[model samples]
Target: MTTIVPPKERECERCGRTDTWNDDTGTWAVVERDGDRLSGDPFCLHEWDINGAYNPLEEGA
Candidate 1:
């Protein structure tokens, strides 16, 4: 058996935009804000902070 681990969430620190991983559609959707689902307001240069300290998929892969 193989275990599939999916990324749950990610946020842009520069613009305070958060996105949740959608397993059904296999895509990242923007989080709900102000009673509406927003998309592409302030296009920011996404810089993911993936560093040495963060390791989620390091177990028995």
Candidate 2:
């Protein structure tokens, strides 16, 4: 027996924008925030919808 799982909704870590996998389009689409199904470019850095500011700190910095 094998189990198959559907792709889970993905949210942008920077803006909290959400996206769902579209089987018809065969691509991950932005389904929330300003873009909303327009494209995958959800985080513009200049504008973020989620809490907290954009930190440029690198790992171990």
Evaluate all candidate structures by whole-model CA lDDT and list the values in order: 0.60, 0.47
- What is the TM-score (0 to 1) of candidate 1? 0.56
Query: Which regions of candidate 2 deviate over 4 angstroms?
Result: 32-61
lDDT of 2 by residue, 1-61 (tens): 9964544455555555565567776655566555345343534442323332332221232
- Candidate 1 per-residue C-alpha lDDT over 1-61 given as tens digits, one digit per residue, 9 for 90 to 100: 9965655776766666677767787666788888766443476775434442444443332
**Model 2 per-residue lDDT at 41:** 51
Candidate 2: TM-score? 0.42
Clashes of each: 0, 0
Please list the residue runs of candidate 1 whose C-alpha ends up more than 4 Å from where it truly belongs after superposition. 1-5, 34-41, 49-61
Which candidate has the highest TM-score of all? Answer: 1
Angstrom error at residue 23, model 2: 0.3
Instruction: State every prediction's TM-score relative to the real structure.
Output: 0.56, 0.42
